[model samples]
Target: MYFSGLVSFLIKYNHLLLLLLSLEFMALSLYYGLFLFLSMMDYEFFFSMLFLVLSVSEGVLGLGILVMMVRSHGNDYLMSFSFLW
Candidate 1:
């Protein structure tokens, strides 16, 4: 997705808030696109619905984590974290 590419670029450049926003945009686009393809068989439609739910939940969780990171660290650049050392 184009939003995913933007997210990667933002992450690479240490733009944390922008990365989270782009991730949300990507997930929203995925939900809309998947919803339009519901003309398939029953089983396939069910699987697509399941994937849509998972993606929405994943995006929400990611945003929550990012908010916590910003609160704890005063910023959210992934590269700024050094706990690995």
Candidate 2:
């Protein structure tokens, strides 16, 4: 529910900052779900650590995207994005 709310907010806002924040929230929610499932299964903490590393990697990637978006558009908006051939 919380993550879905974040998704809705991102869709309505549709800007780079919101996109990055939403991605973090999404990753956190996934980590929570994974932790719960692994705990129930008696899995090791190593899986949670792996997820934490993944979340950090996701933050880096999302920030990279935001930087590129700023460089290309000089502002945050969906319309400013374009594809290259």
lDDT (Cα, tens digit) per residue for candidate 2, span 1-85: 4569476665866576776776677778888888889999998889789889988998998788878878977977766567521
lDDT of 1 at 79: 78
Cα deviation at 62, candidate 2, in Å, is 1.4
lDDT of 1 by residue, 1-85 (tens): 7566565756655766666667667766776677666654333577677877787788788788888887888887777878722
TM-score of each: 0.60, 0.72
Q: How good is model 2 by TM-score? A: 0.72
Least accurate 10 contiguous residues by lDDT in model 1: 35-44
Clash-forming residue pairs, model 2: none
